[model samples]
Target: MNASPVTIPARRGKAAFVAAGQSIKVINTHGEQVVDTWAFNRADITEFMSMEHTRSGSRHIIPRVGDAMLTNHRRPILTLTEDTSGGIHDTLCAACDRYRYEGLGCTEPHDNCTDNLAAGLAELGLTPPETPSPLNLFMNIPWTPDGEIAFEPPISTPGCYVVLRAEMDLVIAFSACPQDLLPINGRAGKPTEAHFVIA
Candidate 1:
């Protein structure tokens, strides 16, 4: 059973400290919302989740059930235990940032996953890396036969979720991606609630 869940508001962020053996379930309260997920060792924030390590260790661009999310030290930080989102998560893309939107022709500032991550980590008395790449949950970025990667709409629907079991004490964070400039969020760009349940 899940513990009480806390909703991470759309275009915002949230985090929690999870003990080893505990798990976190990220839920798409509304369809097509992308959640940028991150994690760090509770005892050492510098040893954070590393997508490169994960892909190298698991030998998959997109992680499958039973794959482990590796840390900078190349140790399992979390393991994918349950997935109901059709494996639409992405690893190739970096988390959106203010500059990315500006380059995309947005003259104004925007809410970004990178900033969200830092803010959330701060609440736990931790600081993230200067540039933090995350496991983009519900994002659909596929590679073509030509070896080109294309961003696409998410395959996740309302109520879809993915659960990860903590392999060690961790500070887990997530951002309900606020990128209104991409189709990854179904072109709505509008943020939606993401339920984080620790069990």
Candidate 2:
């Protein structure tokens, strides 16, 4: 892993490799950007992080520090080690894709997390077996007792971050989600760059 912080540019994505026991610190540089995150087994992309499986394993919609993020195969991939970003994250939403923007009335091609994931992995001479539901870092999705959920701006302040320890040798990806149509990024609807450091 690079010692310097790696940028996940606004409206784009980045990916990296982490060995077991290593940790990655994801920074919300500007505070409001929703980073769509994913992780895969370094030896087998098919065995990737699974939000549904993690939810079943942890029994929590929002993971807290010390919770292990599970893979589709029901094994640990990454574990939440430390968090300073208000403990607000969404594991329920799928990564934004072209069809989502299209439904939101975009007539032109839009930068999206799905594409960004592929692009990021492509940079490492790899491709995603499929787009899995991402761990939406810094995203705020409030739910009601009636089972309704609403997209809201993040509550995290600038420079707040979360650290996830790799449970296995894995590849991690992140997209500084380009969702300007909604306030998921912020009320300003401006998606900004984010950063991560592997240590």
Candidate 3:
């Protein structure tokens, strides 16, 4: 009943969409970093989220500890419900925009992550935005059984956050990943804020 105070800067990435009463919050003011999330429906987006139908219906596709970021038609777009990094977070990991710019070597234009996802999908108005397929919240990317997926470190810290309470009507987007070559934005990256609640 008290979740509001979003300072989500530090290599930022932001997106919002949560109805059915409403709820959205993300905090990690400093201490490892990674925030990427996407849950669709918002009327319908070709029944999105089909990473091969979530690894063939939840056999395994990231999100550990009780896992439930379920999708791929199974519904329920988030259910890790609460975690403090213990479960780690990151669905494979994909947030280094500008064509991943030489795999994030840095050209120094500032405001990366596809410009915070085109300003978080231009606040839903989408002036010049039309690119979907996302869901990253708290990126960690660590899995190498030869498949490969390095980019580790950063399971959230500084007031870690992860809360979801919506079962329908959603269209989330996030970017808290302005990457300067990447370190989960902890090298000189700063400036973040996101807060919303409606019980």
TM-score (all chains, Cα) for each model: 0.96, 0.99, 0.29
Model 3 clashes, total count: 19
TM-score of 3: 0.29
Cα deviation in Å at residue 122, candidate 2?
A: 0.2
Q: Write the residue-wise lDDT of candidate 1 on 95-151 in tens digits.
A: 899889889998878898988998888887778865557999999998989999888
Candidate RMSDs in Å, in order, are 1.4, 0.6, 16.0
User: lDDT winner among the candidates?
Assistant: 2
Model 2, residue 121: distance off in Å is 0.2
Q: For candidate 2, lDDT tens digit of each residue in 1-199? A: 5668999999999998899989999999999989999999999999999999999999999999989999999999999999999999999999999999999999999999999999999999999999999999999999999999999999999999999999999999999999999999999999999999999
Clash number for each model: 0, 0, 19
Residue-wise C-alpha lDDT for candidate 3, range 1-199, written one tens digit per residue: 3345534455565555667445555555565656655566677744544344555556676555445554557776554456565556555555566767655565656665666766766777643234443555566667778987766556666767666655677666666665546555444444344332323
User: Between 1 and 3, whose TM-score is larger?
Assistant: 1
In terms of lDDT, the poorest run of 10 residues in model 1 is 124-133
TM-score-best of 1 and 2: 2
Candidate number achieving the greatest TM-score relative to the actual structure? 2
- Check candidate 1 and list the clashing pairs: none
Instruction: List the global CA lDDT of all models.
Output: 0.89, 0.96, 0.57
Off by over 4 Å in 2: none
Regions more than 4 Å wrong, model 1: none
Let me know the TM-score candidate 1 reaches against the reference structure: 0.96
